[model samples]
Target: MIDLHTHVVPPRTPFLERLAGSDPRWARLEPAGETGDVIVAGSNFRTVRRVAWDLVERRERLAADGVTGHLLSAMPELFAPWAPAGDALDYARAFNGWLAAEVTGHDGFFTGLGVVPVQDPVAAAALLGEIAGQGLLGVEIPSAPPGAPLHDPVWADFLGEAERLGLLLFVHAVGGALAATFPHPGAANGVVFPSSIGQAVGGLIAAGTLERFPRLRLLASHGGGSLLTSLPRLDFMRATTPALQELMPQPPAVYAQRLWFDPLLFDATLLMALVDVVGADRVVLGTDYPFMGADPVTHLDDPAVPAALAAAIRVTNPQRLLTSLTAPT
Candidate 1:
């Protein structure tokens, strides 16, 4: 299984200092040691856990879990709106450069998803261009709303540019004000609800962004925040609303086909249900690795998942999503 949702951080002190200074809330945030790294607080949310995992440790963890490769992403707090945009972009550039350096010679063992400063889409676009030649499989953005919604007109050009560049967009639902309503709200409870992110993705689809940029590959973390169950209602609403009907293509399934979902549901039934709804091709393996409630091995061991589906979720689907990083035929 190729775990597509692991996270990494740069060890540079200046970067950490910048992060600490960029957001005022960092002063009140506490740190916890996990996997030999620390995660600090950011903004009003406390559920965002940050850890700096070394490449060696990450590879070892993958090997132990029978995971072939682990795609590196940013922690949720890394893209907070409260952070300085320019500083965030610089940190992203430096971090992506470091990540690319660490992963390039490892073959399929390690691949990275570049982080972008979505708060500043233009800068984000520039950073995307800089990392285009790097062995980055995709780009990670925090889920919309608390940061930037996918349907926000402000991000249209950025999304369009990403589409033109043939890069996949991976949205990990992060810090938000609505996380308190979740079943198990934590210190960073504001960003814990995957359902809210799913609703945001649904809204983006309803707004015609997917239709507008058909070539753009999108991956929503945490089983697309319950996408399997949400699609039916989304389709029903679209059909009943003339404006939505005109904006979206026939049936919502078309949009589903264009998007990909990661396997982080933690339940065999939910994961399999996603497969039944979106098919095997759109489901990719993701273990919110090194984080609480995320286990790499268990996700791959579900009996309800067929071997082929599991393999696709673990490897093939991610390869398709991060097309640029795959070796040539």
Candidate 2:
């Protein structure tokens, strides 16, 4: 089955080492015994196993996991939204270049989602064209840039470019400002920055961004965080709150159905609920592979799910999304 949520990271190449050492704000890969941890702006962000860098091992592991193909993206922590715009752009290109090089050889077995310097929309849009030109599937950006929310006017240019270019945009969470809320923030406690995802997504829907940009294929990671759960509330608020009526063009659920999401939430009940909310076609299999999270292969075996819907989630849905991605001209 095609897994849309897997991640692959390039090894600590010389360029990255140089960049990191020259400026502390840049991400640096510090070698530890048997594995390594990524240090972003002096804080130990996350550890990476050998498989993170070993493509051969990754392919073999995918075979063992019964996954036929998977989409590759850089680790979200490396997005570095706080870095200087030029440095962020440089890092994005490097990550995309690494992704292109690695995935080009694998072809059918692997597709790639590049990174863009989301902090600067104008520059990000330019780089997105270059990324699309490389035949990369699309680019993954943080749920929101640091100090900037998704609804900010600054993102319009980049989002506009995405629509005009027919590029698929993955709004993955990279907890920057929001992480400060937690006293102890990091992956250890599930301090995943997905909480804002719902708000960002809801705002976009309410603001009629999807309606305005009909071709923008937006996907939310982590089962769209609280998006599905918040749908009913959004609908209620829109119906009751007069001010929201102007913002909401249609029922919130209707716009939600138009977006894509991965079944990264391991709970069968939650996964089924997500399918119910978004429809089976928009729900794709996403293992969050190698994270020791939910296994995508076992999604079909969820007790309450029907055979047809399960099959659609495992295979048909992902194929549709992947096949529909705008290829480089």
Candidate 3:
């Protein structure tokens, strides 16, 4: 099995110490040891003991669970999107560079999704080009600004550049930093809602951004947050509205076919629903590993799921997404 959404941070203590001292916006991160473990405290989400597990250790752990490979993403807070663009870019470069160095030695055993300075698209694009050449799988960006809808035109250039580079784009939800008004407030407390991520994705699709860049592969964390439900509406609007029909090459469903969804939905019912909506080929496995509520392998072990579907979710889909990054001469 291949786990597509595990996380790692730079194991260098100096970098962690520097970030803790300089960035008051990060809710006080404290480096606890020399082996790249840090205690991140005072955040809206649950506090976590972030540690860097060596490839051998990680392999052994996964092997115990029958997982053969892992696709590493940087821990969410480490991206520090709230920081100034220049500082964010520096952090992004440092993190990506460190990830490349660590993973390059392991080959197929490990792969990574690079981080980018989302605050500045032009600079982010340049950094992405460099990382892409290094054979990184993709870049991670927030669904939107702290208090703004993701569909805001501000992020267009960043999305456009990603499309041009032929890189996979992963947009994961950040819990506390979501825009002020929750997209859907009626749901029960424990239930998973796809509001913010859905809004961001919907905004991009409605604005014709995906239409403009046909080759871009966008993956949304948390089963793409309400996007599956919203797709039918988007399709209806496209069919009934003549102007939108002209703007979009096909219906919204066609555009969705280009987008990818991760299987972070812990419930078997939801997972099967996502598979029906996005189809098996577009869904990848994401563990959000080491976080309290996320366990990717649990979904893999569910008896409700067919073996063939589980294998595709666990291994085949991730292989296709990462292998797409091979640089052409």
Candidate 4:
């Protein structure tokens, strides 16, 4: 099966290290033990496995997880939206180059998604050509940028360009330095991250990103966070609220069907709930890979699910989403 949501990071090369250390706002990676590195952005961020940048280990582990291929993006911690625009652009270019080079020789075994400085809309829009030229699949941007939401007028050019190029934009949810608000330990992962994705998805629909770019291959990570449960409410507000009616060309419920989501909810009932809302065609298998635990016995192995539905999530849907889903070759 093709896993759409795996993460792959590059080594903290001298260039990236210098950029982050020189600025307090940039995200920096600090070596912890021999096994991991600490990601410091707003706070002492989480440490990730050494395998994050180890392509060989990543390939072997993907094999161990029983998948034919992986769609890799840099770990969420590496997306420093708060950093200076030029610095973030530099980091993104470096990462896009490194990732494109790493995924080149594997035939179709590896696919890559690069990062961009979403905080700088004009610069970010300008880089799409360069990113597309790098042979990268698409870009992975954080759900939250600096000031305005993703669906703001400032992003129309970027979104339009992505649509024109047929790029698969994946919006990843990241809990920035504001982890203190979560209060309880691990609340950053359990609450903040996924909830952010849901908010971004709803905002985009309510704000007309999907309406403006109907065919934009926009994807939401982590089972679309809280979106499914909020669909009725979104539809309610969209139809009755005059301000929203002017902004959204289509209602949230209808626009939601046009969006794509990964079933990384880690629960069968939750997965079924997602499928029930968006239908199986919109759901794809995206194991957050290596972080949320690789699915040793994946969802496809469940006997309770019909063979047809399982096939769609595990293979057919991913293949359709990325026509170049050429893997294991």
- Say which candidate scores most in lDDT: 4
Residue pairs of candidate 3 with colliding backbone atoms: 194-225
lDDT of 1 by residue, 214-305 (tens): 88878888888756677899889988898888888667877887788877776788887777777879888776766656353475577777
At residue 70, what lDDT does model 1 achieve?
77
**lDDT tens digits, residues 228-308, model 3?**
788788888888898887777677767777788887776788888878766889888887775645454576668988989
Model 4: per-residue Cα lDDT at residue 284: 80
- By TM-score, how accurate is candidate 1? 0.84
- Predicted candidate 2 versus true structure: per-residue lDDT over 64-113, tens digit per residue: 96778888877776777777788778878888887888888875798899
* Number of backbone clashes in candidate 3: 1
lDDT of each: 0.70, 0.77, 0.70, 0.78
What lDDT tens digits, residue by residue, belong to model 4 across residues 1-329? 88888887566642466785686655555655435655564575556676666777778876896778789998876777667788888888898888889899887788889788877988888898898888887889888877777878998898988887778889998776666677774777778877889998888887777888887888799889888888888788877888887778666777878878887776677778878778889878787876764463265556656788888888888878778422222
Model 4: CA > 4 A from native = 14-20, 24-34, 39-44, 183-185, 293-304, 324-329
Backbone Cα, N, C clashes tallied per candidate: 4, 0, 1, 0
Model 2: lDDT to the true structure = 0.77
RMSD of each: 3.8, 2.6, 3.9, 3.3
